[model samples]
Each structure stands twice: as C-alpha cells, then as structure tokens.
Target chain A: MTETVIQTRGLTKEFIRDEFHVVALDRVDIDIRKGEFVALMGPSGSGKSTLLHLIAAMDRPTDGEIRVLGQDLRGLSDREVSYWRNSHVGFIFQSFNLIPVLNAIENVELPLKLTTLTKKEQREHAATALKLVGLEERMRHLPRQLSGGQEQRVAIARAIVTDPDLILADEPTGNLDAASADEALNLLAKLNRDYGKTIVMVTHDPHAAGFATRVCHLEKGVLLESLQADGS
Target chain B: MMRISNFLPLVFKNSFRNRRRSILTVASLALSLCLLGLLMAMYEALFYGPDPTPAQAVRLVVRNKVSLAQPMPLSHEQKIRQVPGVEAVMLQQWFGGTYRDARDPNNFFARFAVQPQEVFSIFSEYSLPEAERQAFVRERTACVASRTLADKFGWKTGERITFVGDIFPVTVELKLAGIYDDPNQNEVLYFQWEYLRESLRPVFGGEMDMVSQFILKADSPESVPRISREVDEMFAVTPFQTKTESEQAFVLSFVSFLGNLKLFMLAIGGAVTFTILLVSANTLSMSVRERIREVGIMKTLGFTPGIILGTLLGEASLMSLTGGLIGCAFAWALCAMISSAPIPFAQLRGLALTPLITLICLSIAILIGLGSALLPALNASRRPILDSLGHSG
Candidate 1:
C-alpha cells in the first residue's frame, strides 16, 4: 500500500483584514499518497494556495489538524515547525524566489546549511542538484543573469538540495513564457516520475495542470472535485 | 546551526545593496566621529597641558590670593623656602615682549624672567647641554630659549636678540645662551630675574622687588597638600596674602577661565552621536524594508529568526566600525598637521589622538550601530514568513 504523505482533516484558515473576517479555507480535507503529483486548481478567490501553505507548515490552521509524513504539525512549536519544514518540504514560488545576492550554487546550498553536512559535502550535493536541473554551467551566475526558465531550474535545484520528501510549488509557471513554462513543467514531471518525489502544485492554467497525476478543484474555499489525469 | 562565515558574505552584500545610501550614511558617521575626537583632544589639552608629567603632582604654585594680575613681593620666596616639605623654590616674573621684526610685528611668545640657577632644578623636564647651562649662569644678560622658539625666530647661540618690552618700560638685549627641549613646554624664552630687576630699578625704585609667582617643589607627592596649606597660612595676615595650589590645579584654574568648555563639548558630542544614531537606524530600517522578500526567501530556506536578526546587526556594526576608524584616522592626521604649524596657542601642541581616545571613538561607533539596528532587526526577525513572502519587492 502506498503511504499517505500528507493528510488534512477539517482544516480552516480565516484572515482578519481591517476588522472584517474573510475565510480563506473552510474545513478542507485532503490526502496525498507517496509519489503522487497533485495539482490544486482554483479561481482568484479559491483556497488552493492557502491549502498549500498549510501543508508546507508555513502557516497554522485556525481549526482542525494537518499531518505531514505521519507527524501532527499542530503539536510542533514554531521552531520545530521550521526545522521539520526544512527537512521534509521544499517550496517553489511563482516568482522564482531565489536570493538575488547569491549565485545559483550558493542559493542551492542555503537549505543544506541547516543539515549536518560538512561544507565539502554541501558543495558536492549542491553541485549535483544543479547538474540534475541542467544548470551545472550556470552555477556561478546570479539570478538576474539567468533567463526565466533557468531561474526556475535554479529554484528547483535549491528545493531538492536537501532531498526533501515533498515539493510544494505555488503557481510555478505563472510568470514564465509558454516555452519556458513548458520546460519548467517538464522538469517537475521528471522530478516526480523518476525520483518518486511527491509534489503539490497550485495553478490556474490547465496546460500546467496537465502535467500532474491528479487534479483537485477548489471554489469559494471549498474542494469540489478530484479528477484523474488525462495522459499528456 | 549555520556557520557565521556562511552568513558574512550575504550580510556584507546586503549592507551595500543601496550603495549610495550606505556610502552617505558611512560618510556622515565618520565626519561626526572625527569632530568628536578632535573636541575631546582639545578639552584634554586645555585642562591638563599638552603632556602632563608625573613630577607635576609634587609641585605647587603660590600666587596672590586676590588675583593672578596682582604681583607678590619677592621677599616672600625666602619664607616659602622655609616652609616644611619645600624642596626647592624659584621666583618667576612674566615679561610680555615682542621681537623687533618687520615681517611679523605681533608674533608674541611666552617670555619669563626666572632665577637662572634655580630654573633647571625646578623644571627638571627641561634638558640642556652642560656648556649652555654654564654659559647661561656665567653671563648675567644671557637667556635660554626653547627649541621651538629658537626655530621660529631663527636665533642661534651667542646671537644677541633685542625685545621691545610691551609691559615693562625698557628695551632689553640678551645673548642667546642655550636651546632646551621639553615635550610639555612650547615657544618660551627665559632670562635672568636680576637683569629685568636691574633694568627697571631706575624707572620704579623699590617696587621692582615684586615677582609674578613662585613655584615650589615638595619633597614627595604625599606632602604637597601640607606644604600648600602651610604656605598659605603663613601669609594669611600679610598684606600680600598667598594662595597655594598644586601645578595641576593651577592649570585647571587657567582653563576654567574659558567657562564650562568641557560641558559645552560634551553637549556637542552627545548631539552629534544622537544625530548619527538616528541616521544609521533609519538607513538600516530602509534596507530591511526594501529586502522584505529576500528575508522571506531566507526564512523559507530554513534560516531562523535569530539568524536573520544577527545578520542584520552584524551588517550594521561592520558599517559603523568602518566609518569610525576612518574618522579617527582623519582626526589623528589633522592633529599632526596642526601641531607642526606655527600656532600661538600652547594647548594645541601634542593634540594627537591617544590610545584611550581611539578606543572610545571605536566603541561609540559600535554603539551607534548596535543601538540603531536594534529595533529594525527585531522587527525583521518577528515578521511572519507568509507576510514577508507575500510582500511585493
């Protein structure tokens, strides 16, 4: 039996803005098994990104519980959550959120600094991760020097450098051109298919969602449907 | 745990991301610290002389009880020498004069008529060759000039220099007997007391037996207060009552004539420090605000809040220290240049930065950095990762 990597039950999040309570997610339930590439699709006001944030433990749920890798996230302190997230989850953002001051190799090595790896081992792992993303020649290039596709690849290298169990991407290809978007999607597909790394992505584009094995739809902070992948 | 070395490059790069703003902030801090160091040196020089010596603690000066302008009778020197703990006594009279030079008519230097034999013994710090000391004693109309004074006026040994007296009603000529070197004394000329008294005797009969002040050396530092008290009490009822104080106190009283200069300097220094603190803090705050997204990226990469705070504080401290050192160096150079110039103020000599002053300047720089960055660092550290990541640019 494939083990469930992420489990959410009755999870809810509400944000208070200017004394007005607006619910972002309402009692959402989600389960993602090991090695499953799940795409969360929703419109502008949907809770797809909010759900991804909760699963990555970047935020706390207002009510109910979330378990990632079979450990209850609510029981952990803020510091423990941070350590657990570093070891268990890798996040990719729409803007390719690589630190501008650092080169590709240094950006990749950032996450591994939290691990017990020696400096040499960190360098070796970072180099290997960059090479995996087809950016071995561009390891010394800063983010501004790289193209949009190359920047996303470097972000991918940074995400996987720690060998995390799950990768969470929020609108990963939203800022890319069509060709670069296709290239970034192909890399995500390869990462999930070959390395068996579980992925949860939030996107509005059906072409981006076509790469995932399963698609979950959300509307008005409610999960409406789960659809099987139509082979791309 | 992240190694500090790993964070240093990022911290340094981030500090100068806004190069213009950072450069301006550093320049402002450096200039302020330079001014602060110079003011402190000036205050020190005014109250303590250029370079106070250990022997100054054991010496006392006796003057008129009413004011320094009034002269004391030269006969009181014998009575002061008789006081207990008095090791040596010398009579000194001020001679206000200017050399008869056409190029510089008002170039005035300190001229005093002191007892030739007792001057060297009383001011042990002054060093002169044996031959010159003998020459100064052998010739009744001979005078000794400081090396600085000799260089300024281009006087040589055996040369006769004439001074047109401004205070006394006599034109005096004397052979330059010797040039002496002392770190604390600057641009002074000393001649025999008898020459001045004899020259003025015919003009003001009997009244010429007055001296400006008397310098007494005690046998030990422990007996200075006792000797001062005994000297003052002995002349309490006399027409020319005396006020006795240590050499340091006498210099301090002279500086007191400037009226609260130390407090004024402290106020200016404080204002400068506070102004720089606000400027540096504002700069750091703006830097943090501009890098909100970058901070969030680091957070997502597993950097703890404490780590972020330390990185920001480290950047601030490094910037401040750099500015402070440059300012101190500039101030030290300025002092060296001033000391070599032909300045009439004796207090401006040896105004260079001391080790204590350097340390203080550096410490203030660090404090400015730390104090300025504290609130901004805390705000950056406490900011939620989601909020930071959500912030645009």
Candidate 2:
C-alpha cells in the first residue's frame, strides 16, 4: 500500500483586501502519495501558491484540516509546526533564497543545525547533499559567486540536506534561463526518481510541469483536473 | 539548542553587511563613551582625591572660618600643635609667582612657604635624599622643588631660580637644595617661611606674620575628628577663628565652589548614554528592516524565533563592546599623557583611569548594545513568515 504523504480535506483560504473579501482556495480536496512528483499550475492569484503554502504548513486554512506524513498540521503548535517542518519538509523558493553571507555548504547546513546531529555529522550530510546536486566543486562559493542555475542547485542542496520526506518547491526555475531551467528541472526530477522523495512544486512553465509525474491545474480557487505523466 | 559557534559567525557577518553605517555608528559611540570616561575621571579628580592614598584620612587642614582667602595668624600653629591628638604641625602659605623666564607667562605652578625643620616630619610622603634634606635646613635661601618641577624647568640641584611675586610686592631668589618625588603631590616650588616673611616685612611695616593655612597630622586616624574639634574650639574666642576639617573634606570644599559637581557629571553622562542608545537603536532597526526576507528564510529553515532574537542581540553586543573598549583605552591614554605633561590645572594634576571606572564604562557599553537591540529583535522574531518572505528586501 502506498502511504499518503499529504491529504487536504475541504481546505479553504480567504484574504481581505481593501474591505473586500477574497477567497484564495475554496473547498479544495487533494491527496499526494509517497514517491509522487506533483506539479501545481495556475495563473496569477489562482490559489496555486496558496494551496502549496497550506500543504507546507506555512499558512493555516480557514476551514478543514491538512495532514502531512500522517500528522495533523492543525493540531500542532507553532513551535511543533516549526519542528515538524524541519524534520519532514524542505523548500526551494523561486528566487533561490540562499543567505548572501554564507557559503553554499553553510547554507545547506542550515536545516541540519536544528537537529540533534553533531557538527561533524551535519557537515558530512551537507557535503553529501551538495554532491547529490552536483555542486561539490562550488560548495565553498557564496551565492553571488554562483550563476543563476548554480545558485538554484545550491538551494536544492539546502532543501535536501536534512533528508526530508517531502520537498516543496515554489517556482524553482522561474528566474532561470531555458538552459538553467532545464538543468534545475532535471535536478528536481532526479531527486524524486533516484531518492524516492515526494515533491510538490508550483510553476507556470509547461515544460517544468511536464517533468513531474502528475500535474494538477487550479483555476479561480478550484482544482480542475489532474493529468498523469503518461497523458492517460 | 543552537550552538554558539554556529550562531556567532552569522551574527558577526550580518553586523558588518552595511559597512559604512556600522562603522559610523561605532565611531560615534566610541567618541561619546571616550568623552564620558574623561569626564568621570575629572569628577573623581575634583571631588575625591586624584591619588588614592590612605594616609590622607589622618591628615587635617586648619583654615580661617570665613573663607580660604582669609589668612590666620602664625600663633594658631603653636596652639594647634599643643592639642593632645596633634602629632605635628606645619605652616603653609601660598606664594603665587611666575618664574622670571617662564615661556608661558600665564602658566601657573604651585609655590608654597613652609617651616624648614618640619618638612620631613609633616610631609613624610615626599622622599628626598638625606644630604639634600640637611642642606635645605642649613641654608636660609635654599629651597626644595618636586622632581617633576625640576625636570620641567631644567633646574639642577645647585641652580638658583628667581620668582617675581604676583601677590607680594617683592622679588626673591633661592638655591635648589633638593628635589623630592611623591605621587600625591604635584610639581611645585617650596621655599623657607623665614625668607618670605623677611622679604615682606619692610613692605608691610613688620606685620607679615599671617599664614595661609596650617596642616596637622593626627596621632591616629581615630583621633582626627576630636583633634579637628579641639583645634576649632581653641580659636573660637579669637578674632581669627579657625575651621578645621579632614584633608578629603578640604579638597572637596574647594571643588564645591563649582556647585554640585557630582550631579553635573551625572547629567552629562546620562545625556551621552541616552544619545548613544538612540543612535545604536536606530542603526539596528535599519539593519533588521533590510534583512526581513533573510529572517523569513531563516525561520523557514527551522530556526526558532528565540534563535533569531539571540543572533540580532549578539551582533549588537559585539559592536558595542568593541567600541567601548576602544573608547576607554583612548581616554586612558589621553589622561596619562596629560598627566605627564606640564599642565597648570592642579585638580587634574595626576588624573588616572581607575580599573573600577573602566569596568563601569565597558559594562555600560554592553548594556547600551543590548538595550538598543531589544525592540528590533522582538520585531524580527515576531514577524509573520508570509509577510517577511513577501518583503522585497
């Protein structure tokens, strides 16, 4: 039996702007299983990022509940949620949010600092993660010292350093050129395939979506349909 | 628990991100603290004795009851010595004069006339060579000068120096019989009372027996108050009544002429500290504002809010502590240099930076640093993750 990595039941999110009510996600029900690469696609303000944020436990739903790795996010305290995020999930941002002052390895080691791992173990894990992302040679370089694709690769290394079961990436290749975008997409695909890591990414690029095993389209706070990788 | 080793580098690097602003803030803080330290030293020098000698407690000064300007009769010295608790008495008269060839005409140094035989007995703190002490007592025109004063004027032991008196209308010359060294005393020229009295007799028509003040050494520190009371009461019936006080009180009374010196010092120090706090807090706020997104990223990476606050506070403390040390050391060096030089201000003659004062200033710097970071750290830690991440810079 494939374990459910994420489950969202009747999840709704609302925002109030200028005294007007805005519903970002309405009656959204979604599920992702272990080892599945799912892509969330939509136009601007269509609730794609909103749904991803809900699943990642970065934001709370107005109604219903979200369960990630069999743990209810709604029941967890803020501190527990932070600990859960550290142990179970990793994130890659659109802009490759790497700290400017830290080197590639130090940025990768950031998540590991929260764990009970010894300094040597953390260093080893960070080094291995950088190697997995093919950034071993650039491990000592700062973010400004790397190209766009290389910085994204470093961000990927940071995301995978703690060996998280779920990796949430929001437009990981949005700022990259075609070549760099392809490189980053290929890296993410490899992470899902070779490591059996479940990934849920939000992106507008069709090509980037094609790299995922399944693509879920959202429109006007509603999920339209999900397409399998085989187009079946 | 975040490891200190891991957190320190981040704090240090982030603090220097805006190099120009950080440097300017630190420089301003350093300059202010330095001025504060110097002012503290000045206050200590004025109200409390500059040199912390324990022997000063047993010493007493007998002055005219009305004011320092009023002189007392020389007969008071005999009556003061007859008191039961008085061990020794010396007549001291201020001789205000300018050296005949002084480079700066307005430059003033302490000059006094004292009884020759009582020099060593009264001021035992001054150490003079045995032969020089004997020679000073033998010659009527011989005088003794502090080593610092002798070095300043390039006067050898046998050299004769002339002074044109500003108060008394006379010119006098004396041979330098000895040079004494004492940390408690400043660079001064001391000549025989007989010489000053004889020089002034003809000008004043044989009525020059009055002296500025009398210094008395009590038999023991426990007897100082009793001796002071007895001496004051003895002169209560005379026309020239006397006011007797401990040496410390005498020095403090001189400082009182400036009016509430301690409060004045506290006001200046408080103003400087408050200004530094504001400047440091503003700088920290700006730095935190610029790094909102970075803070959000750290939070996403599983860093606790407490850790974020600690990191910011750590940066602030490091900056403040660095500035404080530099400022205090600078003030200490400046005070030392001024003390070694020929300054005419007697109150600041031996001004020094005591260890207690240095520690106080450094502690204040740390407090300032921590105090300045409180609001900024709290704001950064409590900011919503979504909002922080959404911030452009």
Question: TM-score of model 1 relative to the true fold?
Answer: 0.92
Cα error, candidate 1, residue B257 (Å): 3.0
Error of 1 at A151 (Å): 1.9
| Pairs that collide, model 2 | none
- Structural similarity of chain A in candidate 2, as TM-score: 0.98
> lDDT, candidate 1, residue B76?
99
- Residue-level lDDT of model 2, residues B1-393, one tens digit each, is 656777776888888877899899889878988988888888877766544355676789999999988999988877888999888999999888778655774356888888888877777788999999988888888999998778777889999888898788988899999999876657777889999999998999886878889999888888989999999999899999999999878877877777887898889999999999999989878888889899899888877788888899899998898889989989899889876666655677768888988999999998999999889888988887888899986
Residue-wise C-alpha lDDT for candidate 1, range A1-232, written one tens digit per residue: 9999999998899999899998999988888999999999999989999999999888889998899999999998777877888898999999999888789999999888778788899899999999999999999999999999999999999999999999999999999999999988999999999999999999999999999999999998989888879633
lDDT of each: 0.88, 0.88
Strongest candidate by DockQ: 2
Error of 1 at B206 (Å): 6.4
